[model samples]
Target: MKKFSFLAAPLLLISSLAGAQEGVPSPAPTPAPASQKEEAQTQLVVLETAMGNITLALETERAPVTAANFLRYADEDRFDGTVFYRAMSVDWGEQPNGLLQGGTQNDPKRILDPIAHEPTSETGLSHTKGAISMARMEPGTATGDFSIMLGDQTGLDANPDGETEDVRAGYAVFGHVVDGMDVVRAIFASPTDPYKGEGWMKGQMLADPVEIIDVRRIDSPEGDEAEPAPKETNSAEAP
Candidate 1:
């Protein structure tokens, strides 16, 4: 198990300048024709961690609400200073498959209200490698936390209860991890253990905590124009 020193200071900081207003969802630009949707779904997001920087392009078409929610948090700066917190890698005979989870700490005001679950039926987004999804104990319980599956995670998308004709629908998948998957794999390989007797842990935890440092939205070219810059003034020298 590789151990990363828990350095409080971040090695790099990537600033996302988009501004998000409360109670106002970011507008979805006009939808592209069917042919263009595939190419247009990609969104770039940079994750500046204590270890290194990881970039991701979220799949908006696959998971609109999930993408919106994530962007909302970034716009609000809710994830600033949060930690990666959870990482797991399954080592079976086959290639390792697991996920990395992170989110805003248990801050009441910062947590966004839960959004409705959009499983494959609604979004057609499968739990494939590099996918990003919300981390919730059960349906309708997701708040600020989210996770990115390192490999196929079809099991997490179905419902656990058999009452529904559909398979056990689990967590709601929102986006995909298009880049920096290596960083995720590294986090999964970090040393971890069950947080003995801790709340919500149920005895499962990461011994060496991975901190998030901060999370902010990557501004689009248009959004970047909205920022206010320092005023430049010319001074005259006395004759």
Candidate 2:
């Protein structure tokens, strides 16, 4: 296993899996009723980037607050003209694994108020391949920045018994890429600037950032307009 470390902003910190502390696992919870076991409501959105379109299905029912926040930005065109400014490549385990970061980059004019931290433990989400998550300096501070994971990154999941805040709270995962992962993979493989970012973010900044032309909700697979189910509670804090 390889270990990675991240500093708070520029973006959220990613802890090294090798250094993760071992603790007693918590007992499993009772299963939800069959009605509640139905798939959560989701919203299909396409991120039209300079490279290509990456489609995402936001889990609004599971991670309501975070999903709604993202929807608001897309609806208002706050993500237009933004760039995928960072790419963190993971060198261990499988090939072609890491994450790409982008968004409003906290542009005061484009970003809205910060939302609450929605740990994966709470939202039942994980930083799996093609997951779309938020980027923030601390819990409850994520605004417009987000990351699209390129591989299974459950290492970023919340550890309730973790030794530190970042580990304990983990990062929120509100959605996953439903299509166009090829576009995401291509962006993750883009060139990076050796001296562009500060501290841990250094060498991870994209040399020629991919521009995010815009983001918008798409019709469901069934060819009907899909409305996000109202979920006021539940998830972020990603790279």
Candidate 3:
């Protein structure tokens, strides 16, 4: 995902297509930060999908606010019917690198408010392979949408030297794929829509989106789940 540069205002509304291409706050050092994971109260979310089960460990200790935001959606059952619609393969080239994008659509009826910006510099998290992060057009636009790095992505991490007009802030990595990376691989290798999408995202949208059956918290007591809202189809409908 592209880190925004010119936009002065925080993108209050993160794009629902993928995670908002923005970043977060906290510190998740290398080697998985087991201590930080525990302190962050890192929790797991099991995603039962058409492909298979994919479990993620969120870094709540390092990125509390961002992790809580993601967990809330899972606990509320808001992700049940959503689809993993975007896959940015190495073949797609520079901008997105290797990754998969999914989450809520820009449906005003169901989307929550955008959270504050959390730069990776602030979080001390890097966009390493298997790391999960939010997406946004501008800082603070991230809502329910997110991206998972398929490979090491130092490019998506905040610039250590300095933030420039070009580098901007990077994506907030709040979790990692603890299990079911094979499932993620299978989905990534799937085809993309030839006729849909535009610009850099053109031809990057999945031809037949992988449906997210359910997202639920595995580490703590969850709240009453609401039935999933219907999936959005027109935006990606085949001609």
Candidate 4:
């Protein structure tokens, strides 16, 4: 087990914001009526894993291009049969907690062209627990890979004073895991060490990697629509 610290700065800011709002209690703001535009801007994806199904709600309003890119991969069934090959709990000096990384890699060709990054400042989404964000070697190098933060990650978010240099930046956070967090926790608890050079564990590797088995869009009707039409019900008795 490792130790991780709270992201002090951002947490502090959030606390201050909370206090300020509390000090001057404003009238309860009426909920804005839902619109078609809102529905059109968001997408729900389900990642069927060996552990269980993990459902994500992608925020397209805050990250249109990034969200679209991720959904495109899902829609194409590119992530099916992939694995979550890397898990790292960074020792940030407190209770150790971290993220779970996974993506489509069982078929190399499924990997698509790289997409541009959308930082938290741009998307207005924090790197909180269950948030699904891109994984990259460096800024602006994200591709088919993505991860979900299992805990708060203020260090990975934006800061004007270069405080986030060491932490990954410019990686788009387009969605959040709305269900199946327990599955994520199970994956995180899988056996891990230094990976031997071979197979799925090549390059950035994990010793005992968790196999994804398959990753598919669970809710969409497109797959069903593609199936042959069922025999129509007839008013007359079956022959």
Candidate 5:
């Protein structure tokens, strides 16, 4: 048998493989799941409105108190027939921080007890586009009312360099719109009743509030074998 130069042959094979892969990029790795528990515990809630269906991914893990409060109303079907009463619209399409507000009507019978305030400082979520935050009169008065951002509003987040806690404190952002932003924008652009709101909220009230037909907690559309996902029925009813 001829001399088999094992070392030289292996070196040649390695060089050939390296040459073949010289310009090729490696495949990207898949992102790791947030957590095993988050996968099963996080929840979705679909709000059926006259315009369309708006799905929200409530961050129960981050803001337990506030998220649970919203769930209470949703689970009890109290959001049904509620209207998108206010849309703080501007003439320009660049509503970088404009707001749209609505929630269960001020019916004492349907309202639940106000929960303790969960500031954005504690939650670590910012007021970015698609963000949904609880609306309150003072610090701890948030209940049924909520607001959705049409554009980024990081200013609404807790300011780290403020003199007082109130100055740094911000609204609790428990969830965000996962789908149907077109519907949210349409509601934002709906004509306003110039004479509806009182002081600062004047002219922000929707001329015709878009009615919410149903609001219910839904399983992940990603599909969990334990439960069936609710079919998203987009409401096409004319306003």
Candidate 6:
């Protein structure tokens, strides 16, 4: 069993090909073609980080609850002065394979109540390259912390039949980076302090956290007006 560590606060921690039906010669029913409107059904939000901007296309239709929660934070200016403070690097798979985490970091004033977990099993989203997923301590404890994948981490996807809760109920991937992966890589490559953080997160804390200047919704769905830019503020504390 592949392990995935996407946790909140204390910690942060599938390409599965379906088997062909046996002896079934009947052709499978073709799926209906997606309309132009359906194809363009996504909410775009940009995180203007100190390093650079990272654009995200949230799967609002498929993962509504998770997407809405993130939007609420952005719309209310909760993440304005937050920083990308953790870079979990691993020497496996691709060269820059791991995750970069940032968010409210459980600031009582900035964070909202935890939302329901939306597993890949239900959302049909995978932890592919540039995928953005929530960071929770348990299956249903995710709040404002999130991570951006650096490579195709299919190992993070839910395994419905797995033996453990962590595998059966995987992390919720609500969106993906549509642009500025180079910025993501650069932040991941930034200096990390060897003596910071707790437990498994030790040595993963960024020596100098990259500030998130602003987070704004650049575009909205049909019939929705774009939200005003978030006011600048600073209230987050380093972990």
CA RMSD, predictions in order: 13.4, 7.1, 8.2, 12.7, 21.5, 9.2
Poorest lDDT segment (10 consecutive residues) of candidate 1? 7-16
lDDT of each: 0.54, 0.73, 0.66, 0.57, 0.63, 0.72
Q: Write the per-residue lDDT of candidate 5 for residues 1-239, one digit (tens) a residue.
A: 00000121111000110111111111212232465225434568888899988888888888888988887777666678788887754333355336777785455655666779887667766667898887754457676778788875554555545444433555577889988888899888899888986644567678899998988777754322223233323232211
Please estimate how well model 4 matches the true structure, expressed as its whole-model Cα lDDT: 0.57
What's each prediction's TM-score? Answer: 0.67, 0.80, 0.74, 0.66, 0.72, 0.78
Model 6, 201-221: lDDT tens digits are: 568789999999888788632
What would the TM-score be for candidate 1 when compared with the true structure? 0.67
Alpha-carbon error at 221 in model 5, in Å?
A: 4.3
Candidate 3 residues 139-178, lDDT tens each?
6877777877776665666554434421356567798998
Displacement of residue 46 (Cα, Å) in model 1 is 1.2
Per-candidate clashes come to: 13, 1, 14, 1, 0, 8
Q: How many residue pairs in model 2 have overlapping backbones?
A: 1
- TM-score: model 2 vs. ground truth: 0.80
lDDT of 4 by residue, 177-219 (tens): 8788888888887777654424323333456666655444444
Runs in model 4 lying further than 4 Å from the true structure:
1-41, 91-96, 105-108, 163-169, 195-206, 218-239
CA shift at 58, candidate 5, in angstroms?
A: 0.2
Residue 193, model 6: lDDT of 98
lDDT at 52, model 3:
91
lDDT score, candidate 5: 0.63
Error of 4 at 59 (Å): 1.2
Deviation in Å, model 6, residue 214 alpha carbon: 0.6
Error (Å) of candidate 5 at residue 41 is: 5.2
User: Which ten contiguous residues of candidate 3 have the minimum total lDDT?
Assistant: 4-13
Best TM-score goes to which candidate? 2
In candidate 5, clashing pairs total 0
Model 6, position 198, has a per-residue lDDT of 63
